[model samples]
Target: MADTPNSPVVDAQLRRASVQERLGALEVEQARLRQELVSLSGELRLPGLYLTLDAAGTSALLVADAVQEVVRLVELEPLPGAPPHVAGTFIYRGSPAVAVDLAVLLGVTREPALDAHLVICKGARPVAVLVDRVRDLVEAPVLVEGTPDGDVALPWDGTGLMAGLCRTPEGIRPLLRISAVLVGSEET
Candidate 1:
């Protein structure tokens, strides 16, 4: 074939092949990282009861058990002008904490037990959560970016949370969006 200005098929083919090779190399790297992650996943653990609650009409995850030790529940002072979601005000760790029932707020038909523990946000002055049955200790895996569509319903818009869903030994666990649950919309 005569070499013309537009005739660069051989060069283009070579370039395409090089790009495919790089992509394959990246896939291999990803596989290695995932294997490393599986091995290392056992090492990292968060000490607390993972509470599976509902907040603002959506399911939420909260680290509850350990927080109770740090926070002290006090007598209800009463917030007369507060919203229906706001159950009452209590002193937890000498800080003002708003005790809000997770069940009612999430519109769950089942009543939330009084025995359920409270989870006060680390920095929020007057925000605390009343969780139902606190779930087992969950060790989450590293998550990757992708579309969110699965069994577990998320707090955000139908899609999943910040870190995305993690592939766990038992099943796919939805990564919790802590901030969203801590300070959910009551104004709206």
Candidate 2:
């Protein structure tokens, strides 16, 4: 190959590959840091929000990272022909989102109170989980040996939807499976 002003000298493909390798390394480092942060929270025994969805004591919650926010319940537009569990649609941050009564979806009989609030879930697609009320976060240390009383049966089992009960000072609280709640097992 003869050198000429118009001829490029460097191997562009090799340079691009080098940058990609660096990016991959950075992503792995980011994941590790995230794990460390979660571990630190566990060590501190930090409190987390747990909800009482029904009078039967069927409670639920998402991982702190999976929760976006808890907002006041407002009028929701009914989704015609939709399942009873569907509370209709609400505008979330200017985007249309379906409001779901977790109790209804779970086949719980109790009705939500007038002051019930909506839980904004975070994931591939955000969805609203309507609960009776939002309780302040509680420190959730894993229980070694205690009978959890409020475990709600899902429509189906064997799918990682149930996270078991975490014994809190108040009582046993059911952990919500973010994937199952956000995207139902049928959808999955």
Candidate 3:
């Protein structure tokens, strides 16, 4: 007997082929998007891409290359005698990383949201920075010193915490100095 178009086997086969075709088209689109990202990065003259996040209601940017991963808020082991900004420590990839709350670092007294995220940063001193949410991946543009007038201001004193300020379509935001946040956490 020959399989008919309306038969269960033929219907299943047609569905499978249709799904495969859609997947192939999606793969091509993904590749095109990736190439466009690289081209945009080159045009922007950024050393690497940046990740934007909401830190205590303040918009900030972090170097994407320095970030190892972003994970959901996990229970942490308490660190006695650690700075106020230091929330606790969590194990990551067989290593313990101190979790620093960006909200506390920015002088916000409120607790982190229930759905907060931890942005694990890679460096000589690895630390997981807690943020309210991960916003988007952006290309770093030319930076200017100090906050520009009418721009969103840094919540904290900034001092060494902020590397500089950069303009985005949303407005001006602080480019956080990861090294400062890392080292400052240790010294304080």
Candidate 4:
């Protein structure tokens, strides 16, 4: 009603701005929903030893006094007829070991260039999970449900990587899924 000539242009601009605002609102709503879902499902924190290493040796997380110790040496073997993510197989404590590239397989930037450690998970299939550094292992909460950021957070049907986050002195630690790492892409 204000003006006849400028109304069309003004209307078009207003419509465009409204669309953009709606899109932004949708994105924010989606993020909030994801966070809520994750909170609802829940995650469990298990008590175990965290190991970190580098050119030097392995170190404990919880106990600061524990001196640096060398990771147990093992022989790596090729997982013949396996997937790409599968680094190889190794023998640890006189048992078959399935080695995987922690960074590449898990979608990390790269192989932990610095410190590396093996997380020994004892379960149906005892396996050692390779990690850049074993940041302290505090009680980590579980992610009940949420839209993960990307494949890195939920790789291979939510199988490749671990779930939940652990806050440590070093930084936020991603709870590595021993099962996912053990299975590799082949299973996915």
What is the C-alpha local distance difference test score of each model? 0.49, 0.58, 0.73, 0.45
83, model 4: CA deviation in Å?
1.5
Candidate 2, residues 1-188, lDDT tens digits: the string is: 87564445445545544654564455446435544654566432325555434322455545565678888888888777777767778899988887777766666656667788888877445588787777766555442222353354434224334444455676655555555555441121
How many clashes (backbone atoms < 3 Å, residues ≥3 apart in a chain or on different chains) does model 4 have?
9
Highest-scoring model, TM-score: 3
How big is the RMSD of model 1?
Answer: 17.5
Name every residue pair that clashes in candidate 2: 47-138, 47-139, 48-137, 48-138, 49-137
Report the error of model 3 at residue 106, Å: 1.2
- For all candidates, what are the clash counts? 0, 5, 0, 9
Per-residue accuracy of model 1 over 1-188 as CA lDDT, tens digit each: 86664568867756655664564455446545644654667333333445454344444444443244423334556678776556677876576667765555545444444555566655424566665544444544434333345444444434223333444444444445444433342221
Candidates 1 and 3, the one with greater TM-score: 3
TM-scores of all predicted structures? 0.48, 0.60, 0.69, 0.46
Select the stronger candidate by TM-score from 1 and 2: 2
What TM-score does model 2 achieve against the real structure? 0.60
Task: Name the regions of candidate 3 deviating beyond 4 angstroms.
Answer: 1-45, 150-153
In angstroms, give how far residue 59 of model 3 lies from its true place: 0.7
RMSD of each: 17.5, 11.8, 17.1, 19.0
Task: Please name the candidate that would achieve the greatest lDDT relative to the true structure.
Answer: 3
Q: How far is candidate 2 from the true structure (C-alpha RMSD, Å)?
A: 11.8
Residues 38-87, candidate 3: write the lDDT tens digits: 45663322456889988888788887987989999898787888888898
